[model samples]
Target: MAGTATHHGIPLRSGSGLSYRFDPGALGFELLPTGGPDWMARYEVLHTPEDLRRWVGQSRLDPTPEPEIGAEDVPAARALRDALWRIGLARVAGEGPADADLATLNAAAARPPLVPVIGQDGAAGWAAPATGAQVLSTVARDAIAVLTGPYADRIRICSGDNCALMYVDTSRPGRRRWCAMENCGNRHKVRAHRARQSGE
Candidate 1:
C-alpha cells in the first residue's frame, strides 16, 4: 500500500527513505537479455549496483541465470548490462505538461490494429516474430504507467544540479529540494556553501 512502484524494472518510490522490492513483470522480459539497444537500456535500469542490492537482487535477474547466448557478434553482454543501467539511472522526468509525457508513452504503447505477421519477408526461413516484441512493448507501457500515474504532480526530476534523476516530492508544501536528500541535495548544499565563503 505504501511501497514504491516498479517502472520497467526500475523501482520508483513514493516517500523518501522508503525501501524497494523487485518484480520481473516490471522488467518486461521473459527470459533474460542478449544485446542490442533495447536489451541494453533495460538491463542498465535493472542492474545497477545499489539498485541490484536493493530491488533487482530480490528479483530473478540478479545473477543472470545463463541464457544460451554465444553470439559474440551481438552486443557485449557484460558491458550492455552496465551501460543500460547507467542510462536508465539518468531517468529524470520533466514537468510542465505531465500529460505530454503520459501521452507520448501511451502513444508508443497504443495497441496497433491486430494484424498477423506473415513472416519477415515471405521467405519464412528467418522472419522475426512480433509476438515477443509486442508483449515486451506492452510491459514497457505498463512501466510508464507506474511512474506517472497516481502522483504525477509530485513526481519530479532533480533541479538541484546537472543530475536528472526522478524523485517524488514529499515535502510539506510539495516543494521537494533534490532528487534525493543524500545525493544531489547534499551536493547542492556544499556548492552553495563554497560560493558563499568565496563571496564573503
Candidate 2:
C-alpha cells in the first residue's frame, strides 16, 4: 500500500509487480477491494473486527477515526460493500441498480454517522469513541451522494484489460480511462508501441 508519488489516490500493486495509485474518486468505491459478493469472496480481507478497523484507517476518511468495532460490524460492512459494488457496476453499465441493493444502502445511510467536532487545538476531528456503524453510515451516505449527484454520469469502469476497478472521471475534461496512468495506462502505451514497431 505504498502511496504513489504523483497521484492523489490510494496506491495498489498488481500481481505482476506494477505499483500505481488508484483513486476510486469516492469513498464508497474503496470498499470494493475488501471483497465482493459471490465469486469475489476469494479476495475477502475483512475477516474480523480488527480487519474492518484496519480498513477504516487505510481509507480516504480524513482525520481517520478509531471506531469501536464489534464482531457484528464485519458482516454489516460486507453487506454494505456488496450493495455498493452492485450499484456502482450498474451505473457503469448505464443500468439501474437493483431495488434490494438500494434498500441496503438506504438502511446503512439511516444510521448515525461519525460526529465531527473541533479539537481544543482548533483542529477538526471526530467525536470520541465512534462506532463501526457510524463509520459505515458515513460511507453509505457518500455513496448516495456520488450516485445521485452531478458527477453521476461520470462514473466509469477502468478500460484496462482485466481491470474491473471503477472510478469517477473527476478530470476537467473527463477523459480518464485507466485506473492509474503509471500502471494500466503505461502498460497500454507500451503494448501499442510494440505493436507499431513489429508492424514496421
Global lDDT scores for all candidate models: 0.37, 0.83
TM-score of each: 0.37, 0.91
Report the Cα lDDT for candidate 2: 0.83
The sequence of per-residue lDDT tens digits that candidate 1 reaches over residues 1-200 is 11112233333342344433312233322112322244335433333333322332243332222122223312222232333223233333232434433443454356431122333354221122323223323334544553455543554556765544444454568777665555556667899999999999
- lDDT for 60 in candidate 2 is 78
**lDDT (10s digit) by residue, model 2, range 1-200:** 11111226765778698776788887878778788998878778999999998777767765334789999999999999999989988888889999999999999999998887765676565787789998899889888998889889998988899887788888889899998888889889999999999999
Model 1 ranges with Cα > 4 A deviation: 2-54, 58-150
Question: How does residue 53 of candidate 2 score in lDDT?
Answer: 85
Candidate 2: regions farther than 4 A off: 1-7
